[model samples]
Target: MFGWLFGRRKQEKFFLEMMKAAAEGEGRRKLFEAASMLGIIIKGAGTDEEKCAQIASGLVNNLLKASGTNINSNEDDQFVAALFSVIACSHFSRILTSQFELSAMLSWVILTAGDIEKIEISNQATEYYIDMTERKAPVLIAAGNSIAKWVNQPTAENFRAVVNVFDHCRSMVGYA
Candidate 1:
């Protein structure tokens, strides 16, 4: 699907330069956008690590051109929620992890708090994240306190807390 996405070889140097620029004010958003783009790009490469890395290299070449990174802008909320679906799907997440420092960047969504978390995602993204963690099950359960953080919504304040809890249990298997 993404045969045209990766045709060159230089990646680390390109990522380094992108990171340097993305560290600045406006550029940080670019990094986040690039992270999301990496997810999209790698998924198209299937389960082959070589192909995923190749497409990822292309991301480095094209990172500077990404736009519409504003998650809170107008209708981007829908995109964010849909991204949650992509991220939660095991097939895609596994493919995405096969390339880059993407796992690190994806934590951008997991570690999100306060402002960025405020973008009404219909709680879809957070719910998906919870499912992702749940799949880790007994292993993650041993992590205990670490996983509890995902259900941070107040028992009363947030309208979706109970709904999220029930939804998570619906597909959870064994001890998860």
Candidate 2:
């Protein structure tokens, strides 16, 4: 039956429950579920811009609290890192481009993780900054300045990656 396949009402209920769990801090299960939902939303077919922004905002707000407890705890760190990875992924970059809050959240995630040599997250954040610079150069330039502070200059790769992002942005503007 179509109902068996879709289970639309059940899906809705599940989503609502997940949202409640995210808000109530029902522990790692809820946090992980919320993070997974964000990944799905970012990677899902079609571009529902408004819906994506709303969901991303909610995820960012919920995870902010989760990040504060025991940064050195592997369990906590992994959960936060997974959520950060989801937010920083390429798919998420597109979903977040139109939303200032989501972009800011992505920047925050990168800055927060940079100290630990989180190259993947940093790369994604740089890519986002590049994309945003192309879309709204002035806004991203200002944002880039803030992101600049997070770079670990002692890490050659990280320094080069940041430079490359700026270079790429410059080249795009030159052609335009």
Candidate 3:
């Protein structure tokens, strides 16, 4: 069962590579197809954190380059935004910390506020970190500090959430 679950991830990675090649060759049609495949992978297999992290890392690297052609274009931005949104809200948030590149990509997602409010995705991301920390302190503390920098500015709602996160972290000090 687990093998079947992870198989889709492998397929997704292969498609992402193909997409990267297509985009590099400036094959717009293939790029679009690759992007669509990525979107499907994100939607379907995103529950696997490592797979989602891998996809996010690839998309961020490729999309940035692709965007250079018309980085500011609404359509291009929407595609990248959608990809980021899926990973940000997926069940694999903790898997993000395992890969430094993916973690950096996640930081970008937070910095850019990519579709965050649209799905309240950023909040979910913070929650994932908090939960991870409850299981292990040091690993998550570093991630928390990095993530905290992104959400440091506290509006009333954000402030409340941050406070709750800190409280959760405090509770798990030696227990974890």
Candidate 4:
């Protein structure tokens, strides 16, 4: 799987550049580019699911925390959420479910949902959330618990976002 993806030196270089772009945290443009590449790579990923999952986790973490990132653009945020959906729909979902810190992904969905007025990004985030929750209910519940306080702050829109996130987590975990 690794060999096929990186078989060509050019492909290797592109991967490295994408990683560099993701790491620099200079702007959302490069992070978006890296995310685009991640979608492609994940879609074509073969065996060696472990490696692919690790890559996904790292790429996701970097993208979410990228310095100067505004997460305000519908198009840019959609791409990132779509990447999560891509992995969710693939065999890689298991790795993501079992090993990743999905709270961050969930946070992204919540935060981005609040920032944008469009439905495209929200739809994608919903897809990813449902995908992860189906396979990792316990993890989702625990993660939700940890962040629920922060998300449910009294001053934050009266906790509408927290209610939404908690409602989803509960429904997924059979609590609602």
Candidate 5:
């Protein structure tokens, strides 16, 4: 669902695609397993405000946690891509805070199996993510970088590299 980024030009294109995919489509239990590895509690939105930063960091760092079924395999690409898409939506949900509908919690998340309703919920959340991207939200830049990290080796070193770029984006002081 995303690409490995190199220079600024490729980064822009990758961000565009990541944002588009969010406007589209889950493994909640598996996701929690990965999240907990980084000490993220997955409090869902509307929980304690103090937990927001933790969730945010978890959203970013979990890219390297490899929440998919088979790490370093082609099969895992979709899994990681889906996770990044959901995290992108979650970032917007956190930005929206309240009145955000079910956008934040991934609408019961993507981990449940064989339950048609949950699958629909997960798909709906994806649509939410996608629509937000259509709106061209600024979070797309950082969100794209998070997914782009995986397109490379998916190592912590690469994760840190993308995160440093993300940090640089955050540190910008002038108008875009």
Candidate 6:
């Protein structure tokens, strides 16, 4: 039992560090590793709804906080997109859609998807949006509303990101 407890602590440490690395623009391997850990925790959370929710919330919070940073590199954009994809693909995704915080974070992701200067970042966000749509995640409507709001914004920032988001949102309308 002590061994199990100790191993859990180690896993937690590893997971936290990887998440930090992913958010801080540390490295790609760490980003993927952290994303993989999230995937494992979520997939293994069968029948453990609280555990799944906690992990999902933590990841979303982290990503939202990290999004405050000005993306400095293509890898940074990829890392953000990767983290978003992991959360978007999770079994808890549908439930997360109903959550105000998670939905807001997702909306922010869609708003920022207009960062088209970074092609990979735009692509990744678009793909993540598509995946969420395919899952029929309930957040699509909230995202659509958010997209409409962003569309009216006067700033040119993330303009392409908005266009991409518009395309994905349009595709998801009939299905989601």
Estimated TM-score for each candidate: 0.22, 0.22, 0.21, 0.24, 0.31, 0.24
User: Which regions in candidate 4 have their CA more than 4 angstroms from the true location?
Assistant: 1-68, 73-117, 137-139, 151-176
> What is the clash count of model 4?
0
Please name the candidate that would achieve the greatest TM-score relative to the true structure: 5
Give the higher-TM-score candidate: 2 or 3. Answer: 2
> Which candidate's lDDT is highest?
5
Per-residue accuracy of model 3 over 1-176 as CA lDDT, tens digit each: 56666698897898899987765444323322433443523334442333444444444444344334222344334333333333332322432224443543454453354545333334444454456656775644543442233223323443344334433433343211
Q: What local lDDT does model 1 show for residue 100?
A: 26
lDDT of 3: 0.41
Better of 1 and 3 by lDDT: 3
**Local distance difference test scores for all models:** 0.35, 0.41, 0.41, 0.42, 0.43, 0.42
lDDT of 2 by residue, 71-149 (tens): 2334334333333333333233442334544454444443354345444444454465556656876635542432232
TM-score of structure candidate 1: 0.22
Report the Cα lDDT for residue 138, model 3: 60
lDDT of 5 at 110: 30
Question: What's the candidate order when arranged by decreasing lDDT?
Answer: 5, 6, 4, 2, 3, 1
Model 2, position 104: C-alpha lDDT score: 40
Model 5 TM-score is: 0.31
List of clashing residue pairs for candidate 6:
113-161, 114-158, 114-161, 114-162
Question: Can you give the lDDT of residue 27 in candidate 2?
Answer: 35
Q: Considering TM-score, which of the candidate structures 4 and 6 is the better prediction for this target?
A: 4
List ranges where model 3 is wrong by over 4 Å.
Answer: 1-61, 66-71, 88-176
Candidate 5 accuracy as lDDT: 0.43
